[model samples]
Target: MTDIPEELALATLACRAGQYQTSELEQSEALFLSSSFCFESAAQAAARFSGDEEGNVYSRFTNPTVRGFEQRLAAMEGGERAIGTSSGMSAILSLVMATLVSGDEIVASRSVFGTTVNLFKNVLSKFGIVTTLVDMTNLDAWERAMTSRTRMLFLETPSNPLTDVADLQALADLAHQHGAQLVVDNCFCTPVLQRPLEFGADVVVHSATKYLDGQGRCLGGALVGSSALMEERLVPFLRSAGPTMSPFNAWVFLKGLETLQIRMERHSRSATVVARWLDEHPAVRRVYYPGLESHPQYALARAQQSDFGGIVSFDVADRAAAWRIVDNLRLFSITANLGDAKSIVTHPATTTHGRLSAEDRESMNVGEGLLRLSVGLEDPNDLLCDIEQAIG
Candidate 1:
């Protein structure tokens, strides 16, 4: 029941913010597993339903556990409000649904997660919403792609598989100039590493299923922004459409937040070592890690992010070579999910970006030989040996 002081560090906020302890005064956050709450009387129930009082009416939109997670995340991200959702994809869908109308346009980064590209192109297009994809690093490309109908500029910095970094401040300025909201997916970096809102972004979206859970346990998502926009647009859409995160998942995410700062620091340090090793390896045709000096956006990443994050991707000769290394890895788990305690190795040409057209993949430089590594808390020396033998 204590307020998070403005002077508290991020580590303090992650561990203690948004905790509303009951009279029992539990030290850790309590897991409220109930579906709904009972009112003290009929008038109280009526008042809650009529929005005259603030109280839990249903789990879908008013679960205490979910709200605690929302409050904690909003505080961490420096946003005034946040709305929790069932999954990361749903978070994006909710953002679009809440803000854009029929025939509204979105200018998005071509180097985004493959599924996100599909969602904007395939799913939202059916509803008359259109998306234009352009190179993420090209400020001029983003300017050219914008139209009068553009309602949003969406992108993921240090993007999936490629580790492509975007100039968020420039993009934010461009979006506002075009009367569009900039929505940055902070999944890869989390708030511990990079905060999009500090750079003038209008909104920040998250796949809490990733680093927020930090162990591949639960699926959830969130949208964070000013209180006015959140209460006016996002909350009502989520309440009615029901893409809401479960109370249990919210609790799990809350636990994940507690250890987020330390975990990210470790992930970044290990990934830097791994990236350097891969860059030196003869078989690795190219390395894509923001921490590496060879990375084209290294300066930009250092400027914008506190850490470079855990993902380290590289190129081989072909798909066969990429699969060989992935199949040979003994220490790394071969899976699509990133931001886990166990390191993951995936052939992006066959898994994450497999659905995109060959031309699309080529444009994004997702080569046939590309392999994505989600470096975890493992010993860096062991990871290097595993990858070295795998490459051989």
Candidate 2:
């Protein structure tokens, strides 16, 4: 294992961190495909299994390729350690299960991904964990939601589909005041734009399935935090539960990290262009993007993030109009997934947030007309032309 300097820029760290070389000295990171590692002797095997030694025992908890990805992401996010998971939802599950017991509670932003709402409301509720959803930007709402049992404050800034930005510092301060940990999902911004840990977040979670994988080629997730939280809490749960990322996916994500920063910058630029175009269009009743001056949290976004992110959402008149636009698009794929090399357009009311009750959807302001666009690396002009033709 070669140590990457702390002083190296994020782009350099992305490329060089957590690199391990074999006896062959290959420049690229090697893939260890074996399920379990071999030990030199019975004593060594016993030691490894008993944690008296630090080496791979099983791929479920210890694999070189996955460890490398974890190390690299931890360094990028300024976290002491990271734990990899099979998918984004699994990461959140592992974090909640590891940190909170029955009778504990979470205060979360209403603007999170639809599945996250279901996870907290439907799944965790069955385990005796309570969740309260509040407006992302309303500090008063967040403060009022906390209680003696509130163990965590969870939110996604520039939130899913809506693009509503939260004040990280304020939320962190509030959580700490109540002796609770602040957990921020960094899926949309990645480390290239906003690092939640730097703003006093105790934990930063990533759907590495999103921008971290860059090309949408793999399903993965990670939790980045202090060594104590990761090793003491999350690791045991992961080892027991076996929601483990495969070595192949980890290798794919490693390559993705090398180009992540550059791709995010391009995505931000293109998204900004599309957002501006939508803001001026008569067909678009409203646009949701932190980069736009019209955005409620534009100033806060400018202060906290290096750039506005790649997602841009807008509303027309109704679901029918939104569907017409989506159906006519030549370039954008109509999919629920986001953060791909190819542009994606989703009607959130019918797809991402469809499962929520109408009242719940209304609270999140995910209207029937809402169209969420995951702007890609395509030429901004080409995307604009596509939108124009679709609208026509």
Candidate 3:
């Protein structure tokens, strides 16, 4: 078999990838909102339902707009198939619900999104699944934590709020050795900064609401992998469970994908400035950007990701100081979400990560003083002033 060209420059792919046109010669992608397609006869409808005719049967399973987004995302991720979901968490849930069994186990990094930890520990536990969370940076711990029942390894590199860099290539190798799959949450870094599949990961998940949309305008998620995994495993679950991505949301996400490369570069540049400035600030105790030299896995981050990413996390003196900074930010959105074209600031201890138990929070080192800053397309100087005045 000939090797596929996964190394095509993303800029080139962004321009030319996933464009399926008809004799209608429409300039922009069209949205298909109808519930069902018009078949020539009952026999043809039956063929579509039975997979004999490769056409859409229902909007829930097959829609042109959703399929367009999937194709575009799959091309960007260098994968054969992509499945979009209603939300980021649903993408993960569908993956587990489709792939893993009741007795199966997962060895995952504790530094993933708080909701993700909850899903695996609390939600999946109800169905007889077991999850063991470990320090993402600890390779030895991951090796020791694996069991015969282990079927998957999950993680979020440059993880939420704290920017902990997990070694994707290493973990992928380890998972394969244990007869398991590695599922990397490509939410923070995105395809613009990192491609886990190139590093040996079996599947890549995305919270398209964040960096992929490059704006907080849509809520969508995606799973990209081999055709076998998607068509056989995850797609069937989505067809029934109906964790479906809307055609409108998918169209919005596609537009976001157009500018992803440039947006991510700009966000990285501004965030580096913010993270560096925060590290030197008087009230700021630490900045948790992977770009920082002081970061624990700085070199690993440099190697694994194309850019340091848009998120700049920091620690103030205490919870009061953190709140002061957040409360005073004039230009940034004070929401739990990140990866927007507009700047966003959040205190994970009280917002995103607050859902985790105290022990869980402590284990992940999500401190009371922690602040997550998602630097957008704003001028870096203005952002610096916004945070500095907030500190004062």
Candidate 4:
């Protein structure tokens, strides 16, 4: 086991953060593929299960590979501990289930992922957990919606498709005043860019299935927070519910982390180039990249994130035109998933946000003409050419 030096740079941490080295002294982190660990005696097994001793007991809630990924991510996010989950949605589910009871309420941003909205509005509602949706950037709206029962505040900054940036510090302050925990989904801008915990947020969530994997290879998610919360709350929920991350996925994420910083930096550069081109193009009605000077929260994005992330969204003439562009694109993958090496183009109105009611979609401004692009590590000129031909 290794402890990363406090002064190491993020680039260094990405590659060196996790505790590694087995009896064989392997340079890379070993994947513990076994489903359960064998102990020397029944006493030792009881000790492991009862928390009287520290060692792997079962892969469902304890695995060295998964623990390594959690430790590395926690180190990167500046949190005391991190718990890995099966997927991004499961991370949010585990958080809610672990901390909030049926009578509690949640204040969430309307600009979050559509699946998150479903989880809150449809799924959690069945359990008597009420939720209030508010504009991510409107502090007054957040304050107005708070109630005595509010237990959690959730949002995704530089929100999905639109790149709507939220004031993390302000929201965190507001949540604290109401005795609610502020949970920030840092999926778009990994710890390499924005760290919500640094801005007073109580918890940071990540869809490790996205940029954390760098490639679209594995599914994983994480929640990072104080050790007390992870040990006392999240661990129990995971132990009982069994929404734990697989050791194989954890190993994949570990490999992805080794190159995360470099990938994000390149993704940012290419995305900026493509976004500027789109902003000037005649076919584009509007661009939603925080890197652009035209973005309303450009200053805040610059102040908070290391760079504008890889996603670039814009409006077209209509849904017909948007679909035509998606159909014509030769280089981009027409998938809902983003944060990949290959560019992805999606019509949020018909794809990601399709499940929501029309009124809800309208409220989120996910119009028929909207097109979201998960910019990749491709040549900007080639992507521009694809757009040029597709737009025509």
Candidate 5:
């Protein structure tokens, strides 16, 4: 019912992100489900295609619903524009494909998702594109890894599964000094808790299928950046390559955006409770959560993020022991996905980051006993009791 507007706070923008109430108008944002709209005349259609007029021509590159989602997400992210993709991986692919030529390099974090690691080593390697993965916490590694060929610095802060905090300001500064763009995956905190661009990241990416969708119902990803880069470079690649986010899924994301703030808050509160409890558990070896007072980067996280994210990673004594706890949990889900309303859990070494070699996993401290928990909006006491029962 409410009109989506540019002049809004992050919380308000979430509720308003993609729905425009136009005409005599309905209260809720309308889903324009038609694949194509008939133009008033042949000349009008030509004008629309030629960019002389502003309206939807096809659901592929241009659609009201998808555009609405893009606008809303972009607004919420504090980005100039956003382009939604079919998946988070697709968004990364589109970004690299569009911006880099044959010789450009990427300085990425080693603690990224396993599929992303594969994309860099396997897929991008074939094209003469070089990616150097560095310790996310070690600024020295990032600086030493950079070369004149480097065009992008890509990382996921409070990185996947481990919740390793990369100093965003430091990474951004280093990248910019070397004439590189900083691409941050804002999937973990979403805009509800953190805005990477505000901390000097040049571009922000998201697995909207996660927190942005909030319900785990659809697959989607997004790239948010300056309008110049998003429209001129990314949009052209998306138009040709066709990894475009579907209109129906975009509508779903739009719906998800409305409650993003509240859900993230609850997720954070619940996660902190779990992380704190785990730190005291006899089976737990180490807990990695920015929210914890004992975390190495706790101060930095507090300075930047409004709240700690839902993800909490911990280590048990051994692989068998970790599996014992994970296998015993009844309420938590054993899935790779995070940022859902229902709590999810996974053993990173054998699941999310399983593809990495032993050395790679070891360097990042992702062990057989490493477990990542994505806390949801469940009762904290119930979740904690479930953990106690599982580990006992």
Candidate 6:
């Protein structure tokens, strides 16, 4: 692979970080679509399988295209290494399976994706791993939740559905004081907007299906951390469990990374406009966007992130009004997924967080009236017009 200078700007690194040309010297990245690589000799095969030599033996654990994606994303995140996985959820699962024992505990934010909440509370509980949920914004709650058995502290900054920003540095400090790793879900704010590792987080995870793909084209996820943690713990679990990212998807993500910085900037700019529009609208009771001065964590967001990100959420009168607005929208796709070139709108209480108990949803602030919008690259004026007609 080509060696990218660490001192280079992020945009330069994104475009040029992980290219390893073959004899063809292709201008664009070449896709290695084969399931396995050919070895020069039987001894070479043995050496590869035995980890004595560095070469691609199988697609499941090692592929040139996948390696390129991992390397580029790692560079962008400023991490020592990165590992790609099948999907966002699989990345989180791999991290947990690799690092924690059955008796270990997790301290997680209640403001995470609903599926993540289910994974921690329902699935992991069956294996004797307990997770304690807390408010993402409350330092006191996070500090109080830590225990001797706590192995991980997990959260999403600019949290899902609500756009709640957490203080990453404070949480990282608190986690380390308790001998725990702070694992941030950098899904909402891709590394283009916010690099959590820079703020003392031990590991940064991504739902590359979102902004990384940028067009809602593929499903992928990744973990970025010290090379020791990735190679020693995460890679083994990925190899054994077979939650591997496809080489084709990795190639697609590589292309996505090239445009990520520019796309994120556009997303942020348009989202700010949409957020402001919603904030002032008579129908919107509350607008949750860190870019707004009215947001509780606006100052922290300005300090920690390059931009406030693309997701904008707001509250209306009730579920009826929320559904009415959703049904009325002609331009925005009503889907649970976010981070796309095309705008998307979702009612959290009925869609993303529907599985959670009503009490749980209420506690997390995912109320029946809340509507989450993933403001896309569409003209801000057009988006506002679409929203205006819908709200009416």
Candidate 5 segments whose C-alpha is farther than 4 A from its true place: 1-7, 22-24
Candidate 2 regions off by >4 Å?
Answer: none
Q: Can you list the residue pairs that collide in candidate 4?
A: none
Q: For candidate 5, write residues 257-302 as lDDT tens digits.
A: 9999999989999999999999998778899999999999899999
Worst 10 residues of 4 by lDDT: 1-10
Where is the poorest 10-residue window by lDDT in model 5? 1-10
Candidate 1, which segments miss by more than 4 Å at Cα? none
How well does candidate 5 score on lDDT at residue 56? Answer: 78
Compose the digit string of candidate 2's lDDT tens values, residues 1-392. 78756878999989999998899998999999989999999999999999999999999979999999999999899899999999999999999999999999999999999999999999999999999999989999999999999999999998998999999999999999999999999999999999999999999999999999988789999999999999999999999999989999999999999999999999999999999999989989999999998899999999999999899999999999999999999889987778999999999999989999999999999999999999999999999999999988
TM-score of each: 0.99, 0.99, 0.97, 0.99, 0.97, 0.99
Which sequence of candidate numbers ranks them by lDDT, best first? 2, 4, 6, 1, 5, 3
**Whole-model alpha-carbon lDDT for candidate 2:** 0.94
Model 2 TM-score, 2 decimals: 0.99
lDDT of 1 by residue, 242-334 (tens): 999999999999999999999999999999999998898888889999998879999999999999999999999998998899889999998
How does candidate 4 score on lDDT? 0.94
- Candidate 4 residue-wise lDDT, 262-347, digit = tens: 99999999999989989989989999999999899999999999999899999999999999999999999998799999999999
Q: Which pairs of residues clash in candidate 3, taking residues 3 or more apart in a chain or in different chains?
A: none
Point out the worst 10-residue segment of candidate 6 by lDDT.
Answer: 1-10
Residues 127-241, candidate 6: write the lDDT tens digits. 9999999999989999898889999999999999888899998999999999999999999988888999999999999999999999999999999999999999998898889
Candidate 4, superposed: residue stretches over 4 Å from native: none
Please give the distance, in angstroms, between residue 119's alpha carbon in candidate 5 and its true position after superposition: 0.8
- lDDT of model 2 at position 166: 95
Give all candidates' CA lDDT scores: 0.92, 0.94, 0.89, 0.94, 0.90, 0.93
User: lDDT of model 4 at residue 60?
Assistant: 88
Q: Which ten residues in a row have the lowest lDDT in candidate 3?
A: 1-10
lDDT at residue 9 of model 6 (Cα atoms): 86
